[model samples]
Target: MTQKRDLENKDGPSAKKVNLEFKKEEIEGFFNDKIWDNKFQEEIKEQVEKSQPYRWGTITELMNDELLRNVRQEVLNEIAFKKKETDIYKVHQSGDLANLSGLDWDDLSRLPSLYKLRAGIYSEEFRDMISRITGSGKLSGVKTDMSINTYTKGCHLLTHDDVIGSRRVSFILYLPDPDKKWKPHYGGALRLFPAIVPNVPKTDYEVKLVPQFNQIAFFTVQPGLSFHDVEEVRADKHRLSIQGWFHIPQEGEPGYIPGEQEATEARSTLQQLQNKELQEYDFPKPIRNDIPADELKLYRGLGQECAFSPEEYSYLRKYLNAQYLEPKNLQRLADVFMEESLVELGGILNDELAGKLMDSIRDLEINTKAPAHSSEIHFPWKCAMPPHKQRFMYIDGKESLEASEEGIKFINRTGPQELPNFQLTGKAATNTVEELFCQICSFFKSIAFRKWLLFLTRLIPTSDQILLRRFRPGSDFILATSTDSKLARDNTDEINALLEATFNFTPTATNSKNWESGEFGGYELCMSSNASDDEDEEDDPAIYRESDPNDDSVLYTSQCKWNSLCLMLRDPSILKFVKYVSVNAKGSRWDISCQWNVESSDKDDEDEDAATS
Candidate 1:
């Protein structure tokens, strides 16, 4: 039998073998003179110590120019990268470089430049200086983790605080084309988000570092406070980098503390649970409950064969296409909705109304500019808060939350306690978009539509919350995760929510060529709620990747399109999100998002009968 030893402690044979690989002088030139110079170390250390959002720093011209350039070329020539996407990032990645240690000598010899770079990064000279500079305590020499990643056009990393496992310091060494300068306008900048509270990050970023070739950016891994992300690469270029971590010392190693690692892990876990509790305070508040039987009957009395009276159809004809209002087409659509719990209807509006809407929206885009940052977005449109959860522009008939730490606390106190009344406030006809949106919301609340929906889905909606959303190009998305089960639980005695709807009012989102394969997002996606025995689902579920495309979980994916309406039954465990709208999208994805609390008569009455009998 083979024996296992504490390699992490640096006492084992593995440590000795690694120690012999690189000499101090060969790798000393890798760092800039200022970094190692005894005279300048204190100045740099002080700067890193004082930095905001959280303590972090960057160093330019890291590694010998010739050696680093050679390493970049060798990597491009030797490696195959697979697209690795998760809730965190979308990037092309090479296999972990740490695996090199397991390869035979011959295989390892084939990658001489990489071996040198790895050894240089872990050198005693660099390690001690990094430890002292970041005040991160001693880092382990035996357990190293690293991999190469390339962020190409449309690639991005969302907000996360690196607090997993034994990692003490997280670092990235950028290697864009050595010969060409990386411009700031090209996107792919590393942005740091400051905290509103310990775990809650402010909506906007405080610091942004444009990456350049031969630059190294790093920060000590502080749970909750160290929030950061890679902005999407907009230009058609690759931002390649080596990403890795330095770990706290392991058993028997210098500066090793027996309980420190476990303590850090426990604290991170506890903070995550606390963070979830804080998020609960931010969800959309709903008013009322399932409409009473008498109230439901009021809508049902509108008549059986169709929802519209002759006069109502005449009024609706001004906007809706007559084909959709035709009896045959309505029956077909209703049948489809009954079985699938979903229906996507194109040409939802009459050409005259469609043309007016399209022209109006196009004019709005050209005349009144959209905000570049979420916070800068004007009222009527409010920025969603604490971007760690989601980022988008929306109108929910409630006061917008301020974007500061105190603002978050204030908003939390006001609470989304009551369901909103868009119709009450929406009655004031303002701009074209507002008028159209208000019309839609009011129509949803009408007796005729309620009757129409009841006949189609066989579920009576009791209450609703409607949001007019503008998924501005480049900066809007909702991360994957479901809402609280309790929000919809009373409708069904079981856990699932009965229904939800999104009326896509986008007038110019039909980029069928791009969205067909999801190459450039702007699609709404939902999956069947995960089963109980599956691994405990993450608080923030990982983004779905094509590599492991949902075998059967994906319930529906509605591509960006104009005048399309989608309705679906909601499952409490189901995860959903609006795929981040790409900067290159035709225009903002406009939609009226609605959540419904629905109940069915036969099922409720049958259960009541059983109880009485």
Candidate 2:
């Protein structure tokens, strides 16, 4: 046994004897200068654009008899034992072919020849040339970090964008069929797509490329729309490639600045936008009915204003009655309004308030069941238009005659006895009655509610104001409006009180028509403040406060699945009620108009021309 072991050890090859005969200087020149020629660059670019998703090729000259044998052996020895996922040891295969990745020397590895080649390719001269050609200062002198995936018979990668992180450019160096041309029928074709939008594009727009040895393909990562997928291999052949990036390197590189400050700032802004609360848009639905009794009560009374301290509103003499109005005490009220388990309400509050709230809800239900009064109409006043456009109307029992260009018109309503019109010159008309009320409460706390009462006086004509009435399904349609200026001053307080009172006595049912009309389908909450006619028109009145159709000024609006709920006041003077107005919208995935700027008008005009032509 000892003699056999000695003989085996003597015959075994030493580690040093297996070192690669890689010509570092030669390989570096190939990547840095020789690989990218005018004809080759044009061909690759055309192929990438033609391919629906991605296109890549490899350099054939480097995959020669001596170099290929030595490189393959070194790869199998040095990389096979290392962590497979690391940058240095990547195994790539498409069909039967496979190769190791990341042999660059400037990285952690000490392979002298490989290091020399990597340095040469990433040298200043090469990067400058690239910068001149691509017109991107961001890519000059970029270092690449990449990993490889080996594919067998059924192994395939689905279509996806390689846009994650800060990848500026992507390229693949082919090593398959050193002598033979990689034909289109071979199945390992790189595909690219023309971007229709940033992320989504026409699926049929695609191009393909059949790679050859000693060839490479590169392209920019166009976020959103640049999507590509690998086609499955049909034949049993191995395809190999060296894929890498031209990174915007750390500190010492040409584009690198003191601390990467700009990149950091951009990332922070993106995160903030992503974390903001979804605005309630169209439908108004209860968002937090499951809160604890006390908490719910507080939230119900204060709305979003609960976030502020009482000290903030000390200027106004109103103190929150925590006992009755705080969120903690409102759970019972919420449950009752929701028509949920009565037993649960009893556990949260003494049977007293719970029973009272429930009774009020039941009363509202009873009123709803009574024969439709001559004045009452369904909640949603109009059907929505496909793509963009929503309409809502309310009719009350009271009647008012208005002199228009046509003639005197008598309008009926039941909600308020008068339309509370305050001369709000720059204010958004679509701001919800509740949101305006909250702002008033927050800002005018120091000033007596009566002092602010004067503002609403200028809003509407005295004759029109008298036409307002309380919203009554049976007798009121357009006749109801608010005449009390003082009550209007504390709009937030008044609206909350009204809502609480309404919830106490009214039980709102899930409108069957609402469900059948596809109102709740695909609903999602979103917010927009731009004064776009298309967007404003798409809002549902039940959830959105209808703004003055004539007002084209910009105003912030929150939307939910049901409708849009907007806060009209922009004055800093009325900031007090900021938290009080909590707009609720139903949860549904509804389509929203993407028109936000004046550019959409051009598109509209073009569309009109097309139709006319």
Candidate 3:
């Protein structure tokens, strides 16, 4: 018997005029009768198990011939002129995936015709049949979200579940070919994975469903278990489908409460899992250890040790752009420094102005240094030292100075004339805390000292770069101005006040501390919420918990030192002989270091000898 005729006549009983009231009763009766049928229940259970994803597929012939033809023509027309990007359309609805709804519905429009086709498939009669077969009662108020998905040869969708807010059932109506089967090799097969766990599963078990014209597939969104993906299309063909959901109706409708509750529970569980995963991957490794050896070698080749080649210059011009100044401009600056005395004079001028001119120069619009000519130049310019080998130094900024037998060589460029000189300095000294602080102060006051300190700190041998600490056993706390104290507490307003009072410069606190230090010399830094602390923790909820002293953890020691140095640098009222300074502490012990390279324009010929002495 025809499906339509069977629905009209029940149990061989027929009437001249079918009552609309009787139709509702008939539909409800059909659903109730199938609710407990042992064979039907077994069919569903077997399908859910054998399919492994609780989905079903069926092909309906000539559902609506003329509408189908028009829709096919429209899809072809859209694809022929489509841009090289993904496009989507939605039927109107409100919720998390609301972008998939509220499409314009004029019959003459191509999209509205597609929408009508979707509405027909999700019609009251069809939904009632689905509800009866699935043992879900009295289906009414079903809404479908339909869209045409055209996947080019390279396009594919990554795995995701159709589960969304208030979605009960998900279905896809296929329109591929009216005469031929949509084969697996075409690479648009619907792939489904059985749920073993939330967000993670054993990938050995999976199933594939190839499409045929007028075929439909439906499944329940079983939270994380129902993972699916669209296989990338291999052939130059369009895979069109009207995808949608069967939703529970608004309040006062039957069967609405149960469906709503099911959706709520599923969404809540998914969100909890998402939050937990986010916290796990927050802090990445500090060192670039994961980079491959070949890549690292390539990066090292780009250092300052190598001379710039034509190709390198071209690349720098293209990639680094405006940062690379014209060769003529560099020559002009070089010509101004023709006299050796000018180099020394510039250093003396910097000392006379103390910090004022240095601060102004730093803030000046002109580009003082040439663009790094090659990767060889990068080593000398490495501003922040690695966590290991971080310590204080003092030296003269004389470019011609020779290295000691310990391989500590100093090449100074105290004046702006010559290229920035560097030295290969040996290990740091194990001086007393007071002596180290004194050296730090002297280094900041002397231009020659600044040059040597800058080079030595950056050139420590890789093997000897063991992390160091200055520990004081008795004293557990250090004293500083209220400004410095507020920084440790992360008070922005106080930090700004300190900056203004010291350097006469102000910057917004958008950039956080780049490095941090803790007990036993642990150090690391990056833009992330996760970092280790050294001090003891209290019950204050506003402050982050401190690191455990007993347990060894790497703290961002450089960040702590940089913060101290930045505070000192901001004060233009102080000496300007140094370009950088940092402090390191463990327990009560602390070491402060300063570094600067001179600009030649500030020195005089007579001052050169005194400066070197």
Over 1-613, each residue of candidate 1 has an lDDT whose tens digit, in order, gives 3222111232323322332355677778766666778656677689899999788988888788888988898777766688865434678877667666554454445566777888888877888888888888999987787888899998988777777667899899999998899998888999999887777777788999999999999999888788888899999999999998898898988989999888877656235734556663343433334555687666534444666778777866766678877777888887897777787778777888777777878888878767877657665567765566677787776655666666666666765644455665465545687666666666766655666666666666776667788888877777666666675453344324747778787766655675666666768887655522344532222232222345576767787778877778876667777777778776788887877777663465578899999
lDDT of 1 at 266: 68
User: What digit string (tens of lDDT, one per residue) describes model 3 on residues 443-555?
Assistant: 23332222221121211111001111221221111111011111212321111111110111111111233222222221221111222333473111111212222323321
lDDT of 1 at 446: 60
TM-score each candidate.
0.87, 0.34, 0.38
Of models 2 and 3, which has the larger TM-score?
A: 3
TM-score of 2: 0.34
lDDT of 2 by residue, 189-288 (tens): 6666544333333233256667666555556544444445444444557565555566554666658756443453333212321222311111111111
Off by over 4 Å in 3: 1-46, 55-70, 74-116, 135-142, 203-205, 258-273, 277-613
- Score each candidate by Cα lDDT: 0.72, 0.31, 0.34
Clash count, one per candidate: 4, 137, 40
The reply for model 2, stretches above 4 Å from the true place, is: 1-73, 76-78, 81-117, 138-143, 257-613
